[model samples]
Each structure stands twice: as C-alpha cells, then as structure tokens.
Target: MASFPTETHRFQSFDGVELAWTEMGPGNEGARPVVLIHGYFSTAEVNWIKYGHAAKLATKGLRVIMPDLRGHGQSAKPHDPASYPRDVLMQDGLALIAHLGLADYDLGGYSLGARTIVRMLANGAAPRRVVLAGMGLDGLTHTQGRGRYFHRVLTNLGSFERGTPEWLTEAFLKTTKGDPEALLRILDTFVDTPRDAIAAIAQPTLVVSGVEDFDNGQAHEVADLIPNGTYREIPGNHMSAVTRPELGDAIADFLAA
Candidate 1:
C-alpha cells in the first residue's frame, strides 16, 4: 500500500523544462505546508511517500509537497548538459514554492535534495523551519560522490567493476529508473553551493542523519554550521536510513515542535 494518496502534477521549471510534483494532505488553509525535495535519481514517491514520511506528516495535519527535481523521474530529462545551468537547479525548487504561494511553511529534503535546500537558503528563500537530512557540510562545499562518481558511472556504464562506488551508484540510479543521459549532464552542473553562505541561514533547522551515514562527511558538524541548527541521529546509513520508521518519527516530532 502507498503511504500517502497523492495528487500529482507536472509544471514548468524556471528554465521551461517540464517537471513533476505530488501533493498530499490539506490545502494551505487546512494546515501548515512543507515542501520536500527528493535526492538525485529519486522521485517524490521513492523518497518521501514510499517510506511513510509524507503520510506521517499528513496524518499530523500538515500538508506535504514533494517534487521530483528536473532530469529525474517524471520531470524533463534533457540530455544536453548546457540545459542545466549552474545556478538554476535550486531555482527550480524555489520556483515551485512560489508557485504554491507559500509565504510561511516548513521545508526539507534528503541527500542531493538537502543540498538543493541549502542552496535555496543561500539564495535567500526562508521558510519558517527547515529540515536537512542525510547531508553534511562537506556536501555543500563541493560535489563529491554525487558528481564525480555518478558521472563516471554514466560515462562507463556497464564497464564499471562490481562493488565499486561507481558501480553501486549506477545500480542505484538504474533501480530508481533515472534518465542516464540527463544525469550525466547533471554531474556537470551539480552545485558546489558555498559553505559560508549556508552559515547565513538563520531559520530554525533540523539536520537529521543516520548513525552510519557519512556520504557528505560529518553530520553533526554540518548541523553546527547553521546558527540555529539541531542534529538528530537515526538508525541506518544513507541508502537504508530513509526506509526506517525512526527517521520519519524524528522528522514528525521535530516539525511538530
């Protein structure tokens, strides 16, 4: 059974790319809203709804909005690398929030999604409260495994040796049904969002990570970077953390507080 009964839609990105999104729970007036961004190669259904996070929030009377970033899932998969300008990926997210007319709301995302949220903060989009999950300070400094290895995987494809990070990344991307060519170019444009700028984010923030997850380096340190950030540890690692109930529970409790 699906975690949340979602109403999905397709919208134009800031660059006119057709993007996809899904909504669960109430309208703006019915309850508070949260915009959740999914990680690279992941759709809204995989990241939020599949793991019960969105449904849990919806049950708490909060509206959850999940968008599949461009070049992933149902969104446009333009194979051209130039289609993704360095400054526009995060803008796609901000554009969605503005389209929804959400002046006051919470926001969150996981992995690449979290990185995008940090860039959004750096770009001056302030939500009432924010959640940065499965991401760390190292990630915002530059694109590490996300760009280099994912790019390698695409370039080599089946040539990658089994058990390597590139191999694993290719498998994961394939599992998620990601667009290979679009992702290859996404590597060219993945934002190395500035760390000093991220520190300027003053909104109350929650940085959640699995105890074993360090894909972007130290989780606690990333939380410390924000003036008002708090770190919460859940069980599991990067790939498995989102599937755990504790992750959703922690998020629900923190947002409610």
Candidate 2:
C-alpha cells in the first residue's frame, strides 16, 4: 500500500500540557473528519500510521486525525504524578478536537484509546459516530484490573522471565522508548465507566475487535451495551490485530458508511 502524506502538529491541552497530533488525507474544506486515538504506551505512528490504518482511512477521503497521547510519542511526558489527574487523556482528546475546530467528526480508538473514547462519550462528547476497537465491557467497568497489571509490569521492569506477558509488554515498551515513570503515573489516571454510561451513548458505534483478542474482555458485550452499536470481528489478537489491514479496512468502511 502506498504511504499517505502526514503532518504532525502540537497543541496545548486543558492544563497547558503540549500534546502532539498528526493529520492524514485531504486538508480541503468540507472533508469529513475522523479522530483516531492510539492505545496505551503506543503512539499515533505505531498504532495508526505505521500499520497503514491512517492511510487506508485517508484513501476513503476522510480527514484522519491521529493523536499521540500524553506521555507517549512527540507529546510532552511529565513525570509529575499530579499532572495525570483522572480522565486526563479524555480531556486531552476533547482539547484536541476543540483545537482542530472539529464539530461533526467521527471518533475511534484501540484498547486504551477505546476506553478513553468511552469516557469521552460519558462525559458528553458528541461525535457523529464512534469506533471502539480492542475494547470490551470489562475494560470499561474493570479498568483498575488492567491498570494494576500494567503497574506491576512498569514497576518491575526487568525481572519477568522470557516468554511471559510482562516480558512481552516490556519489550514493546522498549520499542516505543516509553518512559516508565510517566506511564506509571498514567496508569493512575484510569477511571471506570458505569454500565449505565455505556448504554447512554447515543451515537452510532462500531465495536470491532480481533477474534483472538480478549485482553479487554468481549467486544460483542460492549456492542450489546450501546444503544446503537454493532460488532465486527477481524483477524489476529490484540497485538497482531492492529498490524492487519483488516482493522483499517473495517474502520474506514464504518466511518465512510
């Protein structure tokens, strides 16, 4: 697949933290906009652009806005624990949308990004549509479970035996050159979303997940919870699924429709 042109820009969030976001596809007036947020410890480049997801969406003639979450990628990584208040990521996403002047755009996120989208919706973000990828009901209601697991992984960096889940996560972290201190603080910022909040989401939502991915629970359950939600299963697991073209294809098709 041909690479799509991308532009990276920075903006200040609600707390004056500088965050970075990338843009793909046509910049012309009246182009439909879609904001794609990356997962935990992952950047917009790794989760979206690196695997051609952004490009695929761009090919559909949609403006793809990919943001590198705070403490990841080109965004400022503050080590201060106080800087990462509850729902800071959601606030950052909201700020990015405002900064870009996007009012009628679509929103999507994978894993942590997906959870963030749920928080945004519960907090009254009015996206025209939403795509929750690699997320499930447990992910929203039982966030502390995953947060604790990641805390262990981050707190105990090099002690995990080879072939263990922690080892694999640590390996991926190294690839991303993530800051454990900042990310550890990020883990504290996670907040659970009630089932009532999930059901209250009014926008049409697509809950798409990898067939083998259960890292965040069952995607179909998430779909079932939303008033206007549908589910789709694609190839691969949580890690491998993002590398598949099918992930991008599903998202582009949904947003275009």
Candidate 3:
C-alpha cells in the first residue's frame, strides 16, 4: 500500500486562519519539497492516505507536505466566500511555503487543488515543477454547469440518489460540505481571464489527465495556456485516477525527472 512520511503541523494564514498540514517523507532530502494539494471538498488524509500513494512518494526520498484547505479537513472553515477567493487561496499556499522556509519545491494538486495551483503559477509563485491532474484546458463548460451541474453538484448534499450512477452520487457526496452557493458565486466572479493572464505562466508544468476523465480536454487546454508544459493521459476517470497506483507512479516519475 502507498503511504507518506507522516507528521502533522499547523500554520496561520495572513488573516489568522489556522491551516493544518501533514508533512511526509524525510525532511532531510536534499531536493526541494513536494507539496500535495487535495481537490476541493476533499481532505488530504482521505484523498492521499486512503489511496496508499503518500507512502510510495515518501519512500522515494521526496519531502512532501499536504495541507487541508480552509473549510476542509482539520483546517478552519471560514464559511465566508471572501475568505476562499482564488487569490486568497493562492496567497495562503505561498504563506505555507514561507512558513516551511522552502525557497522552491515541486507542486502537485488534483481537481480543484490542481486549478488552484494553476492560478498560483499565473500569480507568480515559482515552484520548480508542477503536476496538474484531473483538470484540463476546457475549463468548466456551461453544459456541465447548468441544471444538473448546479443541482447535482454545486448544491448536492451527500449521496447520489441510490440506483443513479454511483459515480455521480459519490462525486457529489464528496463535495457537500463546500458551500455550493459560495462556489457558484466565486465561479461567476472569476469567470474570465485576460489573454495576458493566460500567458503569464512560465513554469515547466506536467499536465496529467485520465483518458476517460471529464476534464481531460480541459487538462489539455490548461497545458496550452502554459508556455513550458507537457501532457500525458492515464487510464480511468477523475476519482480512479487519484486512487490508482499507476497514476502516482506517473506523477512521481515526472516530478523526479
């Protein structure tokens, strides 16, 4: 089973929100740290540990850190939309790096976490390398964001009506604690990016997506947005992409490279 070097610590953001984290691997590794950011609505322990991937990376001699984003895991949940703004999340992450005294590191995130990493790069945080999985270029589409998207996802409160596709319910159930209304508002507020903003990212990015994933296309789109980047596809959809070992191997290999 995959596992990570485990030690828990806390850091306070600029606004006094206490952020919780699990640091993995040997802190003595000469290489830069590898920070793992979990998807929105998911906590680091549930997403990384449950899959056994954390241990795999730890054994590879990479320093790893997984933080519970505000409102998820052990982190404080402000429940205020302003507190979770895209820019604010990026700033909090930078604060975490500074707190650890890491001058540079490899960055990795899944789904919402991945999206946040992208925004962080655009905002000028320089991680030596980046791994963006489960998010792609197509960004969220109106078709997916309307009707079922809003009801089934944004406002979905646990469990997918049984007998309905298990995947549908599971994904929705995973994201329930996140304020749907707040999410929608943020989406509306940050909808468009200036063409210049898209061109701002210069990081060497590894764009990863599952061949059967909903955001595969978007993952490609996100890659195109970066000046120096590459894309690779693995088997499975969003959830399976994270749980499967092959995916972790691919990520570990890419970051090590």
lDDT of 2: 0.92
Residue-by-residue lDDT tens digits, candidate 3, 1-257: 44445888998997788999998786675845888889755778876766766766777778778998766678776656666564566777788888888877888888767766766766667888888888765443222332234455555455556555544545544554554454544343233234456557667888888888874246677677678878888888876787788777877788767
Candidate 1 C-alpha lDDT tens digits along 87-153: 5678898899888888989989999889888888888788999999999788888776557756667
Q: What is the C-alpha lDDT of each candidate?
A: 0.84, 0.92, 0.70
lDDT (tens digit, per residue) of candidate 2 on 1-257: 55678899998999998999989987787779999999998999999998888888888889999999999999999998878999999999888988888889999999999999999988878999999999978999999988889999998999999998899999999999999999999998999999999999989999999999999889999999898999999999988899999999999899988
Which residue pairs clash in candidate 2?
Answer: none
Clashing residue pairs in all predictions, respectively, total 0, 0, 13
Instruction: Give me the runs in candidate 3 sitting further than 4 Å from their true place.
Output: 1-4, 29-31, 140-160, 163-167, 170-196
**Candidate 1 wrongly placed segments (more than 4 Å):** 1-4
Which stretch of 10 consecutive residues in model 2 shows the poorest summed lDDT?
1-10
**Best-matching candidate per lDDT:** 2
Please give the lDDT score at residue 203 for candidate 1: 88
Candidate 2 displacement at residue 160 in angstroms = 1.2
